[model samples]
Target: MDTGKKVGDLFGRLGKVPGRGVGIGLQLLVGAGGLAYGVSQSMYTVEGGHRAIIFSRLGGVQNEVYAEGLHFRIPWFHYPIIYDIRSRPRSISSPTGSKDLQMVNISLRVLARPDAVALPRIYRQLGTDYDERVLPSICNEVLKSVVAKFNASQLITQRSQVSLLVRKELTERARDFNIILDDVAITELSFGKEYTAAVESKQVAQQEAQRAQFLVEKAKQERQQKIVQAEGEAQAALLLGDAVTKNPGYLKLRKIRAAQSIARTIAQSNNRAYLDANTLMLNLTDLGYDQGATRAGTSKK
Candidate 1:
């Protein structure tokens, strides 16, 4: 009977525990529902290096933009559209040519940053895909406007000027898109194979012309050098002649050498050659005697 009483008490305690379990289950369900409701109604955070544009479900203007930090909004109704505010690169390709109908491919690399303040306005009109809608349009228009002003040769040689024109035009056009153009670089320029060959041939001809000019200048300098050398030798000869005339024995030595050279030549010939200094002096004395007699006779008369 004592054992039966103990079993009956255990059953009573087990029935009380089931009642408590039911109450606890009700509390847990209510807590879970409350948590779910809280999470669904909560505001989410958007962080830095990013910008958000608030779009209205009704469709119209996105008037508010969130930049660079935590932000909150109604979960189901209002949502955030994130856009990167960092530097980005965009390329623009165009089929451009000179006035001569030479088709060349032109491409430019552009550095850009979205204006944080103007994000809402930009998102409303241009949307998140600014590269396709705004960037290419700007590039095409700018390139066409720039290319139209120059010839192929000028555009190739003066690329900086072309880039400047692109930058200025694109920057102005990008104002509505909230894009700030940092730089526009003309990175690639390709010409047709035939045009390239013609350019090479022209360059080769120019190099040859320069080479010929250099050779002509060298030859002219060489000719002038020869003329100057001859003139110098002539002046030296005149000076030497003056020096020889000033010195008495200089002519006598030269005459002796000349006579010896003549004697050597005559030795091989049948012609008789006499070399007598005394005979030479006697002839000079006889010429003086004749001149003196003529002067004395004229005086006497």
Candidate 2:
């Protein structure tokens, strides 16, 4: 049989054993949590449209570019530099003088992407925001140079050729800086207000000149019509005179027709008309009749 104090002391020892076990369990849990933290830090995943580059303390930048998946780097010894390798659209705009000394506004749009194989070099030189550094400078240069070669009117008329030249030169220039430009185009183009007004005035002047030319041509046609009418009337009068000279009886027939017209007019009128015997419409004596009368008078005498 144990004494009372001894029993109390034994209970105390049993309680301490359980407390030791709890402390050791807590230590194990803490160690596991630390290990998980370290593992998460050393590894990373490259998602879609993203690339990673490794930098070593001993080496500046490694050339092996990492694609999408699990990748590991030494905790604090190696650094993983991630970049988004996606096509992005960027616009650049500027005011430039054209070849004809016209002030012009121009806008250029480009689709830019970093070269996958050149990721290491790009990181070393331009870093994460490489497109920001590379695109604007070269695009400004290309726009100014290309626009300077063409007149303001040519920029509007030969716009396709201008865009082609801009695309060709910009693509080449971007390639030099480890950037790939999928497309380049002139998005906007405009000229000064004074030039626009001048063009409008020129078009108005051209229309006015065309109207004047039409009026002149119409006047010439009218003159030709009057001359033709006069020639026709003169030729008809000459033919009538020749007919009267060839046929003496034609005069008597004309006189008879005139007399019939006069009688019809006088019959239709309400007023009384007294015509003389010698009048052209009333004359009925012939030259042969007159000669016969004279011969009879002489014989009688």
Candidate 3:
């Protein structure tokens, strides 16, 4: 019985040893809280579509631009400032018009992407407010400067060219801001009321001139048709005259047919011969000559 009791005591002490060790280990871990937190701060994640810059009191730290995914740094000595590396667009409305100075309304759409390789230089020089500071300043400066070169009418008409100029100038200036300008476009352009009205009137006049030209062409076509018809009739008459010369009997036959047609029209009832008074007198003279010749021949016998 005593031996069993001793064995139980030994096992109890052995269990206590593990508990004491675990307690000491926990206490040591608790005491190093600051160190653990510092270590944790050294590691972070730069999510997709974002790039991080490590900033320190030391000017222009060599290591910069943490790409997407987990990254590590020295705790408390370095901090990461994240910037969206995705493409983004910014726009502004045009300045209103003035009397002494005519103004044109212009709206611009600009595409920009962060310079991933130049993040350290950008954060050092341009700082965190890249959109508010760098983008707007470049856009406004380039827009106003390029716009000053053209009149209001020309600005509205040649907006595409103006946009190209803005893109070129801004692209050149963007090197300093550590951004790449992908595209720049002037999406909208407008003019004052009077200028719009004048343009409308000019369009109306152009349409009217086109309509008048169409009418003139139609009249010329009608005149040409009349001339062609007259020429065809003359050609037909010449052909008919040649046929009559080849067959002289055609005229006699035509005269007899004309007289017969007139007779047929007057004698509407068929099988009835209608003779004029001159034809009756010529038949009676031929009958009187035949009677005289017969009576003289009998007397001579």
| Best candidate according to lDDT | 2
How should the candidates be ordered by TM-score, best one leading?
A: 2, 1, 3
In model 3, the runs with Cα more than 4 Å from the true position are: 1-26, 32-35, 57-69, 95-103, 147-163, 238-301
| TM-score-better candidate, 1 vs 3 | 1
**Order of the predicted models by lDDT, top scorer first:** 2, 1, 3
Predictions in order: lDDT: 0.77, 0.88, 0.76
What overall lDDT, based on C-alpha atoms, would model 3 receive against the true structure? 0.76
Prediction-by-prediction clash tally: 0, 0, 0
Local accuracy of candidate 2 as per-residue lDDT tens digits, 1-301 = 4698899999999989999999999999999998998898899899999999999998879999999999998888898888888989998998999999999999999999999999999988898899889898999899999999999989999999999999999999998989998888889998889988998999999999999999999999999999999999999888866655565455567778988898898889999888776664555576764465456445544
Candidate 1, 1-301: lDDT as tens digits:
9999999999999989989999999999999998888775555566778878776667644777776767666565667888888889887789876667777789889988889888877776778887677788778877877787877788788888877887888889887667888878888888788888999999999999999999999999999999999999999999876755565345456656775776677689887867575433333345655565456445544
- Would you list the clashing residue pairs of candidate 3? none
Candidate 2 global CA lDDT score: 0.88
Tens digit of lDDT per residue, candidate 3, span 1-301?
9999999999999999999999999998987986788878989999899988886756546555678999898876777889888889888665644333566666788889878898777777777677767887777777778877887766766767877788899899987777898888888877667777877999999999999999999999999999999999999898866655565445445655666676667678666766773443323245654465455444544
Better candidate number, 1 or 3, judged by lDDT: 1
